[model samples]
Target: MPTVSDFIIERIREWGVTRVFGFPGDGIGAFDGALGRAERHDGGLEYIRPTHEEICALMATAHAKFTGEVGVCIATSSPGAFHLLNGLYDAQMDNQPVVAIVGQQGLASVGTFNQQESNLERVFADVAAYVQTITTPEQAEAVIDIAFRTAIARHQPTVVILPHDVQAMDAVTPGAEHWVSRSSVAAASAAITPPTEAIAHAAEIINAGEKVTFLVGAGATGATDEVLEAARLAGAGIITALRGKDVVPSDIPYHTQQLGLLGSLPSLHQIKRCDTIVLLGTNYPYGEFLPATGQARGIQVDIIPEHLGVRYPTELNLWGDVKATLTALIPLLRAKEDLGWQEKIAEEMRGWEREMLAQTEVTFETGANPRKVIHELNQRLPENAIVTADAGTTADWFGHHIRLRRGMRGDLSGRLATMLAAMPYAVAAKFAYSDRTVVCTIGDGAFQMLGMNELITVKKYLDRWENGRFIVVVMHNDDLAQVSWEMRTEDGNPLWEGSQDVQSVDYAGWAELLGFRGIRLHDDASVGAAMDEAFAHDGVTLIDAYVSKNVPPLPPHITVEYAKNTAKALLRGDPSELAVIRDSAAALVTEQVERVKGALHLGGRDDDGPR
Candidate 1:
């Protein structure tokens, strides 16, 4: 008879999970022993040990997000299991398939106040689609099967709790052969196609409108070609949610950038003008940016039926795989002949691009401008690069500036909006595709959160990272810049004392101490050289760029209320606040001036503006 640990490992391997991420702990000794045994044998799974459980969880989430496969992570009981919550929540919110295996105390110690004993099933219930604790060896295979099936089928996180003693018990062998087969696992996940009536109804809604817009999301990841074909047939402008930024290349004629808070003016303009909005695989939460309920007829397509019309009221809801639904609906849609709306949106997009270039050209007198750093990085980024960004001002610059090419991949915390995810995402992207170039853009505050220590994990695995180039660009602004901006602009309050401000660290020195190449950049002029140095370095590298904290990330469409709040905040007599407000106002004015110049045909070549 095989041990419970062996049975669990066999089932995971059978499900095509090749790697597991986590740290070691006493509660998981038996599971760790089984992992070692499996690794020693051919065709067995490998273990990726990150420095912290949170990093492990993040790596697993990134792996699933990038590969579209089930990402597996392991952890010990209590605090160790608790550490996985943040990253698991990222996976949950992003709708990625992730399975977390957590070790628990012995069954006999239940409610006995043991040192590492806690109810992990209850703790993970909110974040996981399925959460269960295995009490007996007989239930091992069944529980593991349910967890993997639920995660893959629902595209969400799943949890399996394993008690210490139960993991070492004799496994039930009666149905082991059936449970450990690849076909059995594959059968649990089947493809879904929308019904004929639903497809016809969606096509009818799209054909009735004069101006249609395709709003993409993470659900549209692998359906790019199909989505683009649909856009071409319908003469629709394409706008993506932040999670769907990589669905279509930025250079596409119909592509109008992203929407919502971290969105573009071109996208917002197109959304307002469109008569019919076709939501493809995205449940974009900001319904205000979309056409009002009665203004535009909406048609939503998604794999999950419940997500339909949750964001905006839809006239037709098509439930199925995005690619499959698009394939079926293409034949039913009447090809749009008039290209007037698409052309107009494209022209406005060009003007927006020119305005954006002008902002990138704006320089600070004291420190590096964060937008410029992102622009330079975007220019030098490899075609096959995998870029990840942390939340805050760093994401603000990256989301607005970085132009992801056809073959590139971009990852962020998405709905979770967590900080310190960029570094771990970069590491995991490198781990998943060792030959690709991976770059992570992070803020100074995010770097300090959990990124500072995780560098050691990158250094530890550097020798094994074959043909991969890892570059971390730290935008050191010396404070929680996003929070400060929110306080002044959103709340109409003065900057808080020391609560949101943080002391800057020698990030370059820290990188050097960890046995990686480190480059510190103090001026805007050094950005290109530092980027080159970091990329050329054989191992992991960090480019510590000192950026201006006074620079603000302006919204695409400024409102009267926002302008009033900003004026009141600036009047409170903080020099830095006043400087930021003045600079932002100037930038806005310059952008509007450039737009007006372009409209009057008084500017240079569209692409050869100020930058």
Candidate 2:
């Protein structure tokens, strides 16, 4: 009685997908027909068309991360699938669960070089946990079911490509049944492995050492509580990379500091003082800061076996889930009763937090310090506001300054650090969780890369007058300073660092043209006023803050060695090593300038407009 399209929609319902994010084309014409029928039947599934396929995939990833459900995204044929690859790679690296359904050219076009022909299976092979092409209508239903389960079970992304001709064929009866509800679903605890005797032995090594440290990475996502428990028991100092900041707040008592190129002074100090280092769930790429082979015996633990010993030499490697391993080891390890060392570290952490907070105060009289604006935004935001951050300096700043409330969630480009994911993600976040406000903080450089195409989707949805959606806040500094700094040299040679002049582009005016209620803030005094106007406006709004071009964010986790080496590379004038050093120095310089400028500009310039 029903066509193949109806059967596919039924399967999607079974997978608990109520909304779909995608771009439709002729290859996916059957999806449109099916959507029309499903809407008439009150299926609750609606299609949202984003600007690019990559954005569509990222939106789904954000939705899944926020809601703990399988987020669905669709695309049409080869071009669409190719675009989806970048976002899917990001999701894979971040370990987010998502389902991507791509429409392929008709069966007749197979091996015939059709207009949109593509080897989608190969395209997604490296990025996806599961990639399959559904050829027949019968196989389509079965493979779709498998795709959903694989994506959810593994907490990984899966791609299903179907030919338009397959959906047009009519043979099998539609019999896919949906699970309306289920109780007592299992948590992802199985993925975590129990810690072996190595952890206990490693704790003994800590007991022997006068100074010990704990460094958490992005892989420690759900194990924050467990990691904290272990740290407290061992009386070991704690630190994390920027990606792991959300794992443990900077306010924690024993928190030493973060490590890496962007690490803080406190973290660098602790790294140097510690006699033993216990690495947890982090494969940090910068190996220069790590202790040499004999100095610090590194004990690394991770659920994924292949990731262990990739970055630094490991004295001991334990393969297991971070939370489970920590839980098992906590009981076996004895607490260090002496709190003198930990107390000192805690004092430094508190002092650092206080100093950073005070830096924003100096800029308050000048009207919106970006940091202060972020803090205020964090306060006014709803308890469950979902923030999607774009790549570059905006991500670094947001990671450090945008204090996360107990229930709030934030999504970024993950380990791959792709650009232009925030806008579409905000759009999808709105559709997935209308109860929560969605905010996108993007750098001017990153926004210019992908914001225009996404605005069309925003205008389309706003014309329909949807309520309680998303808003974008652009830090318009008018320069690709982040990249330029990476290319710069310490010697100030034009041939070394190249050009820093960014073309003067008015992003806010462009947003206005794209049908968003756009506002260009000319002074710091207008941040709150502009925010008020933005929230009150009906559809989408863009608040463009004219920020300092040279101000780069200094994350609370940068190290001195990293900083010194950066200086050396610049001083040496070695084009090879200098290229690497320039990025770190430029980042530090940018942040230092902002700190110094904020002090100098006290009560001088507004936070808006070019000085």
Q: 1-611 in candidate 1: lDDT tens per residue? A: 67999989999988998888988887887898888888887646878898899998998999999998889999989988999999999998888889999999999987798989987877998999999998877678778888888888898999998899998999875453544422246535335777898888888888888999999998998999999999988989999888788889988976877886667877887787789999988878887788977889998888877798788878888778999889999999899999988987787778778887888777776588788888888888887888999999988887789888798999899888899999889888888889888999999999999898878888778776776478899998788889888888787777775677778799999999987788999888888888878777767888999988877787787778777777777778654765686667667777778767666653343322331
Q: Model 1: which residue pairs collide?
A: none
The lDDT of each candidate is 0.84, 0.69
lDDT of 1: 0.84
- Candidate number achieving the greatest TM-score relative to the actual structure: 1
Worst 10 residues of 2 by lDDT: 179-188
How far residue 252's Cα lies from its native spot in candidate 1, in Å, is 0.1
For each candidate, give its TM-score against the true structure: 0.95, 0.80
lDDT of 2 by residue, 1-611 (tens): 66677777777887677777788878778866777888888854877777778888888887776666788888888888788887787778777788898888888787787799877788889888899987766566667776777777666799988789877677364354472222222323446564466767766776676677888876677887888888877778888765566677545777744565445545765776677788887766677677666777677877667778887776778887777778777776678888776876775555555555654443422223565556555556666677878877676556556655545667677678787777777777777666667789887777777776777777777644346446788877655645544443222322233444445567777878976788887556777788888776656778887765444355454446534544554565634344334433444554555544543443434223211
Residue 88 C-alpha lDDT in model 2: 81
